[model samples]
Target: MLVAPFPPSHPLAWLDSHAARRREVGLRRELRPRSAADPMLDLAGNDYLGLTGDPRVIAGGVDALQTWGAGSTGSRLVTGTTALHDELERELADFCGAESGLVFASGYAANLGVLTALSGPGTLIVSDAANHASLVDACRLSRARVEVVPHDDPAVVDAVLAARQEPRAIVVTESVNSVDGGLAPLRELHAVCRERGALLVVDEAHGLGVVGPGGRGLLAQVGLAGSDDVVVTVTLSKALGSQGGAVLGPAAVAAHLVDTARTFIFDTGLAPASVGTALAALRVLQAEPDRPSAVLRAAAELADAAGVPAPASAVVSVVLGDPARAVDAARACAERGIRVGCFRPPSVPEGTSRLRLTARATLTDADTALVRRVLAEVLVPVAAR
Candidate 1:
């Protein structure tokens, strides 16, 4: 039998088409490398405590580099587990009032590890509608039935868990919504989970350094920190101003992740330098318990300047509705020597494009005043219009 010749198709032609579509939709993204010595006031980064450049944090990284070399050099189960890693994990778990902890290469990895390890086929995972992309992706990869409930709605989550046919169920949420800085009702969620015999996993990425007493996070604030049914995930990069993530919960959960989490088994361990830096930053936070409150105050000030409601965490979101308007507003602020995050879809929903301003504990009154002036001149007109 003779087969007709197939029509030729260009594999890479779709790339240009997609690029054009993104540009047309005002969704094209590009990287703008920033200078280390740039004088711009930064309100875009997640260095909540401003310890990323602190001398103590720098010294800790340098010391670790000198002692353990630059990298972990292997996976945690291989040759990567160092003394610094163990120490950081222990201290982090203790700080959060958890029984044990396991560190991962990134917060994304930590979320992936814990969710996948704790849930599988025949399990039900009830997630919040406004969870971070990492959690959304984790749910897709968990091989479990996932039900997305309304954001911060414990009733919906409880109903979903109660109605599930799966014998084991997990409820996952962020302690603080990353986009709008809304606080989750952890106590209510935990109660619902307990009544339904489900486990609660709270991602404390935003709450770790910006909420609760001494920045112990929302879980701790709600008296669920050490609960057996509650597990927590946090990023060292945000609050600790380091470069790793961790899962904090019962020792059994940590052990389970170590044994079953592919991200943990196949991925390289957190760097020794990051481990040391995070340790130092945690100590600094413990000593200077007032830093978290400073961050909240700064956020409130930023929100007030933007003419938005006060934030519950270190994030002040100014929604401008249109993507182009949001971009222009962010650019205007940048031109005035203030840097802020311009979030467009799909970072936020359509028609909800926003300027995401993050607060740092080290931001001075002068910085806040400058930010206020810039927002007044740039954001106010756009928001009002």
Candidate 2:
């Protein structure tokens, strides 16, 4: 029964103790299984236009599955490329006003690809403090000298870029911050980059199909859609109600990514069904251009009911003011047949703990009212907790 003797206490053993602590602090995370038919008001997902379950979109996926089979088989360079991928790229670029577009397996991959390929050892990356985790990781992996600046501060960006001695630099930001749904001052940021001869990269994951006129996205909405100096990334899983992501920018930038973006070069291509579903969703947006407006109205109405500011995008973050209360509030909503996003410290900025509810275009009048009622009832008590 003899084995190598060691102290009962070790660093690895601390993981279990940490889990217990998370449970006590109400910060533990466990996957909640759901049946396909689970009947709950879903405000925690990113299916903004609600095409995720639309008959037309589902049919498109089914057709793609039947025609293309289940797996992509290999990296896109080998067996994964299809005419559908090409068509999606073309339509997405034209709609978003980018000269070209490159699709990725996910928005995370797309952000990493753009950053690594465009930046090198001496590149200076000035990123917003509120940028998504994906962009933050990209900056870290790019080997660029990175400086985190205050949220939505164009003046801070200008100061950073001016102070940097490196001649080659890139400015990164999110058009709409996920938790707070606050819009960035894109034009001012773009102008600063222009003045400093730096590149501006925007992650528009939450803004596409929810911000621009006709849902073209934040860049187009802000009149920077096709600019040669700006590069933008978007997630199809969001407002599109599909899966995958894309980067839109100059033709040269797209070409450079194809050459050096490790994610695209090494990872398997997105599935055909995803391509088809996203295409269907984009067409849905085109045919019914008013969905974005309707969703905005619903969001505004819901915010008013909660006595908080309306969301700038499809995301609405109800400030719960404390981490433990935020978790409790989310659980309460789930108990009442509503689901919402729960964010706490570390996931969110240190002080901002809130219930992040995403809006969808297909939310019926009754459904939205239920959302307001359930969310308010669950959270109003948390304000004092």
Candidate 3:
């Protein structure tokens, strides 16, 4: 086999064309770093329980850093598995009512690990249309036939599963849709999967620590936790105030992932500091069971201010239908000393670009009032128009 020589052209020139196209479509983005002591009221971040900067969480990270040094030093299969990792995994599993759990470098990696490890050529994946990008990517990488059905429609999922020729199938969805904050019909989906003999994989990244009793997770709330046919994936970076991901399910699933999940076998283990921080945050949630309700209340307040429907979780999305308008509204809010997220294509579909406002359990009445005022000024007028 003779290999042809590369074309005589600049290898990087195509990037400039792509950049120009993005700029023309109002899709170009830039990074803006924040200072450690910034005073802006933050509603853009995913710190739902407001534990990211809590003294206890900070102390936990500091302790882990002092004890374990900077990094894990290698992959988990090598020399990276610390006592902190083990404890974090066990505690997360126990909290979520799962028989076992396996931690990954990040939520995205966890999805990739579990989906690819569980499904292959002989498997089929029924994915929700509105699932997170990570789950979409995982389905693509799983080497399985994927059927994207309408979001939150268990009937379509059931129909697809019933017609699949593959010997095995997996139904993938988010317990709470990350963009629109819509809750999935989990019980219905579970029932469909059970009838079809398919496994259900729920990404609880946005649900864990915000949508269940004592922040256990949506699975526990819906009476499906620890089920042999269901698997849950979560991110520590969200409500847990840390930086890692985990897959929770039966002990057999964890064992299989440990043996064959490429992401887990190849990537460096999560940092010990993140493990310790997440553990402390979980303990705080257990001690302060009201935190989850507080988050929901804050989200409702934010939604009412924005004139959007009540959110199912901590995310309150106010769709502006145009990317430029959403960006301007977000900028206006920031100018008023309130920081909120501005999501546009391709984070969302066209005509659904919007502001993604996340509520924090620690937000006070004054903070809510301030946010309401800001949204009234910045978001309401545009939404009305």
| Top TM-score prediction, candidate number | 1
lDDT, candidate 1, 167-194, per-residue tens: 9999999999999999999999999999
Tell me how many clashing residue pairs each candidate has. 0, 0, 0
**Which residue pairs overlap in candidate 2's backbone?**
none
Report the Cα lDDT for candidate 2: 0.87
Residue 319 shift from truth in candidate 3, angstroms: 0.5
**Model 1's TM-score against the true structure:** 0.97
Candidate 2, residues 152-222, lDDT tens digits: the string is: 99999999899998879999999989888889999899999999999999998998888898988788887
The TM-score values for the models, in the order shown, are 0.97, 0.96, 0.96
Given candidate 3, what's the lDDT at residue 89? 89
Kindly indicate the candidate among 2 and 3 with the higher lDDT. Answer: 3
Per-residue lDDT of candidate 3, residues 1-385 (tens digit) = 2334444486866766777788787787878899999999999999999999999999999999999988999999998999999998899899999999999999999999999999999999999999899999999999999999999999999999999999999999999889888889999999999999999999999999898788887888889988999999999999998999999999999999999999999999998889889989989998998999999999999898888888879999988888888888988999999999999988898889999999999999999999878877886677666
Q: Order of candidates by lDDT, top first?
A: 1, 3, 2
User: Which scores higher on lDDT, 1 or 2?
Assistant: 1
For residue 83, give model 3's deviation from the true position in Å.
1.2
lDDT of each: 0.92, 0.87, 0.92
